[model samples]
Target: MKSPYSAKIVQPDISLSICGYSKVLEIVSNKWTALVVYAMEDGVIRYGEIRRRIEGISKKMLTQTLRQLERNGLVKRVITPSVPPIVEYSLTRLGESLLGPMRVLNQWTKENYSLVEQARASYDQAYYEE
Candidate 1:
C-alpha cells in the first residue's frame, strides 16, 4: 500500500532532518525509556511508583533510564527536602510533546498487531520451519 505522504516523505528535507530524528529515536528507542515516560504521563510520580508501575524493570535500569531522560531534557527531576529526600519525576515540555505520538503509535499497534503476527508466522514457516 502506498502512503499518502510518500511524496513529501521522500523529499530532500527529510534527508536533512534525519540527523535530528535519529537522535530523538536513539533516546526514545531504548527498551525502558517509553515505559518510564508513560508511567509519569498523568502527573508527577516518585521513583518507587514508576518502578512499581513497570513490571520487571530492575532498580538499576530504571535509575539509568531516568538519568538519561533527564540528561536529554525530556524529564525533570526534583528533590524535596525531607529526612529521606523524596525524589519526584515529571515530564518537561519536550517530554510532554512525545505523548501524542506515542498514543498514536499505540493505537496503530492495536489495530495492526494481528496482521503483524500473521506476517511473522508466515515468515517463520517459510524460513525457520523448513
Candidate 2:
C-alpha cells in the first residue's frame, strides 16, 4: 500500500523550516494583487493607466499592491526623468511565469460564473428563504 510518490517528497523540519509558498500566497492573495498583475500583463504600463483600467481600485490600494509586488520581486518599477517624472510598472520574468496559471484560473472563473450564481441562489433559497 506504499504510495509511489512518497519517495519524491521531502519532509521538512517544522520547527526550523518555513513554508515559502504561504508567503507567496499572502502576496498574490491580497484583494487587488492579481488584478494589478493582470493589468500589467500587456507590457509596461503607467500608474494612471493601471488605475484607469482596474475600475474601482482606490489610489491607496493600488499603490500598496504595486509596492508589495515590487518588494516580492514580481514587478519592476521604472522612473523616467521628465518635467513630471513618469513611472511605469511591468512584470518581471517571475511574474510572467504566473500568467499562464492566472489565465487558466481567469478562464475557469468566466466559464463557471453562471454555475456559481446558480449555486448561490439555491443555497440562499434553501437557507435564507426558509
Candidate 3:
C-alpha cells in the first residue's frame, strides 16, 4: 500500500532549476522555524503562548521567525480588537501540509539521537582529547 504521507512524484523537468528547493530550505531550516511550526500543530495560539512553549527563544528571534513564516505564506496572524488587543497565530493550509514531513523528521531524530551522540563522543575523543 502506498504511504499516506508519501508525496506524489511528477516527471522531472530538466528545464527547471533546483533554486526553489534551496529557498525553501533557507526558510524552514532556520533554528526556530521548525519548532515554531511544531508548536502551532495543536491549533491557534497567542504570541506569548508560542514564546513560552518554545524555551530559549528570545522575543526578538520569535518575532522575526513568526514574521518570516508569515511572509512565506506558511502561517497566519490574527489580531483581535479587544481591550488588550489579542494577537494569535495559526498554521495556514500550506503550513499544515508540512506537518507530515516534519513529523517524520522528528521521529528520525529521536530514533537516531543516541547514535548521533555516540558519533559525537567518538569524534571528540579522536580529535579534541588527543
CA lDDT of each candidate?
A: 0.93, 0.90, 0.92
Model 3 has an lDDT value of: 0.92
Per-residue lDDT of 6 in model 2? 72
Residue 33, model 2: lDDT of 87
**Segments in model 2 whose C-alpha atoms lie over 4 Å from true places:** 1-23
- Checking candidate 1 for backbone clashes, the offending pairs are none
Question: Model 3, 5-101: lDDT tens per residue?
Answer: 5966586554324677666688799989999999999899999999999999999999999999999999999999999999999999999999998
Is candidate 2 or 3 superior in TM-score?
3
- Residue pairs that clash (backbone atoms under 3 angstroms), model 3: none
Evaluate model 1: give its TM-score.
Answer: 0.84
Predictions: Cα RMSD each: 4.7, 4.9, 8.0
Model 2 steric clash total: 0
Best by TM-score: 1
lDDT tens digits by residue: candidate 2, 3-106: 87677647644532367766667778887988999999999999999999998999999999999999989999999999899999999999999899889989
lDDT: which is higher, 1 or 2? 1
